[model samples]
Target: MSTILTYHYVGDAPADAGSHKSLFVPKHEFESQLRAIKKMGLETVSPEEFHAGLLAKDLKRKVWLTFDDGRLDNYELAFPLLKEAGLKATFFIIADHSLGCEPGYITVPMMKEMLAAGMSIGSHTLTHPHLARIPAEQLAREVAASKQQLEDALGVAVTSFCYPYGNFNAAVQEEVRAAGYLLATATIRDNRNCDADRWQLRRAMVTPGKSRSRFRYMFSSLYHWLHEWKNRKRWKPREEA
Candidate 1:
């Protein structure tokens, strides 16, 4: 089965870190994780590659790397490391937070640079709001408008959509499909199998500073199946931003 890993921040922690500190993955640890991914012989593919391969059933132990929030550190830190390792990743950007609107989010120029460097870009929505609890009209606007905004800004078709905070439902999934996204990702609520659902792709989160054994376990069938069983009866779409 192919596995996709999701990440958030990729940089050193600030001296005066706040609640978001746990989201920050140190530069050294991030590099180590990449090396481990390589050592496992899992090729890092883009969303398009995964989609095509999924349809063709031609992938073997393939993996896709993804970053959420479009943090500037992804450009300043993860970009160089990924480039150096000859690997690629997809970044999910919040449309309204592009450029100067957000303090730490990646800017327009950085996104263009990432695209130029062969990385994939996707929509995380216009304002990163929770979709499961929003009004139908607002949900439609967030799913559709974010894709349009990113395509207009980057001049590329944004084919992937990740639910903000991994929040979504049947209606939200349909909206994402209606928005024209070929693939999407949700954290902790999905499996490694690509045949599950196109619009509600499952991804495992990769936190920094974990042992090699832990990382290996994350990609194992046991972990995936166990997580599935654990969440099956209690399954509910996330509702937080």
Candidate 2:
């Protein structure tokens, strides 16, 4: 069994919470979470490692640590903590927003340092736009441009993604696939996937809450059912209207 842990801001931000809304995970809390993972004995692997060997059907449970958006805080807050724990994470950055955002943004130099220090980088599209709502060509442009920018800056293969706003349809998934992404994390909760969902992977949303529900969820599939029901309902009402 495997679990993907999703995160956003690793450090404090303006309370406004723009860009990635619930993606924010405070620094101290993140450390606490990582410590918990270690203390609990779950082997945390990179997405690539899971692909390689961690996902064997009989393999013990594992986790993947993922961060979204290219915030300066990732470099400032998350990096040191990850280093102290000797753990690595995959950071899905909005390549175009790598710099020149508000008070601060991640620069190529910062990205370079992380890469050198063993962190993996993935794309979150060019402008962080909703790929599902845009025109066909615009969607293609966003995917291609982000992949290119990250490749040029990081000088490594940028292969994974997490859909912006946690909203993507089949067309959007295929577009990202055609653009060369090997894996993508959706905002869906509770369901752990098999090999068929390798490209469109499942990541449990790690909010300020839900960290301690492990034993509860383990005992009850109904807990997972209720969570999925609510999240799916979160999207269905607009269509009915």
Candidate 3:
């Protein structure tokens, strides 16, 4: 089982300190975490690797470092830090909001530059809306349209999807799978997919507030066990059927 490390803003670009979704990691702290990722020997893997691993039952040990919303801070802050570390990551972009070829969350030049610099781009959705309860047509639009948007913008095949807010059900997953996505990541869900449930891969939320010891613990399975036991909050059960 691979632990996918999920992150948000890195540079705190919106510049507001109190935003919860942002979770702005300052440049220095972000660099520290990047160093930690490198020092820990967690080889970064793309979603394509996860998909191929599911098919071949290969477990060579890798971490999928992913960022959601395609935020400006990701391009400004995270990109440089990862570059310095000689690493790369996947960004899931909400497509409809992209104006002038890039959304306010991220700019056009940033996307162009990142692709030019060898980064993988994925689709979040066309509008970043709640998918589980939306109409079928709308859901299809969100799935297919956003992918088309990404491929057109980046000039590469966009095959991964990350659920917005981690909200997705069986039908939603089916929609995304049929829409040509190879892998889909869900928030707050964790497990190694054994071919049957590869679409909804789980991720671990690594926050700036977590201590270095806790960070180290995350590289092991014990981290999830201890976190769940300590909190007593039932995990959204792994897809075992």
TM-scores for every predicted model = 0.92, 0.83, 0.86
Give the C-alpha miss distance for residue 103 in model 2, angstroms: 4.7
Q: Model 3, 1-241: lDDT tens per residue?
A: 5677788877544545565734666677778877887887767767787677778877446677889888777887789878778887888888876534454487656777877776778889988888887998999999998888778776788889998977787888989889889988887634334576567676777666666777666667676566547434543443221
Name the candidate, 1 or 3, with the larger TM-score value: 1
Q: What is the C-alpha lDDT profile of model 2 across 12-43, one tens digit per residue?
A: 55668776555667777788877877777777
Writing each residue's lDDT as its tens digit, candidate 1 over 1-241 gives 6678888999877878787777788888889888988898888888899998788876677888899999889999999999988889999999999833588889988899988988999999998998998999999999999898888877999999999988888899899988889898887544366556677677778766778798778788887888788666555433222
Clashes within 3 Å, all models in order: 0, 1, 1
- Candidate 3 positional error at 41, Å: 1.7
Model 1 vs. true fold: TM: 0.92
Judging by TM-score against the true structure, name the best candidate.
1
RMSD of each: 2.4, 3.5, 3.2
Consecutive 10-residue window with the lowest summed lDDT within model 3 = 232-241
How well does candidate 3 match the true structure in TM-score terms?
Answer: 0.86
lDDT on C-alpha atoms for all candidate structures: 0.84, 0.72, 0.75
**Highest-scoring model, lDDT:** 1
Error of 3 at 195 (Å): 3.4
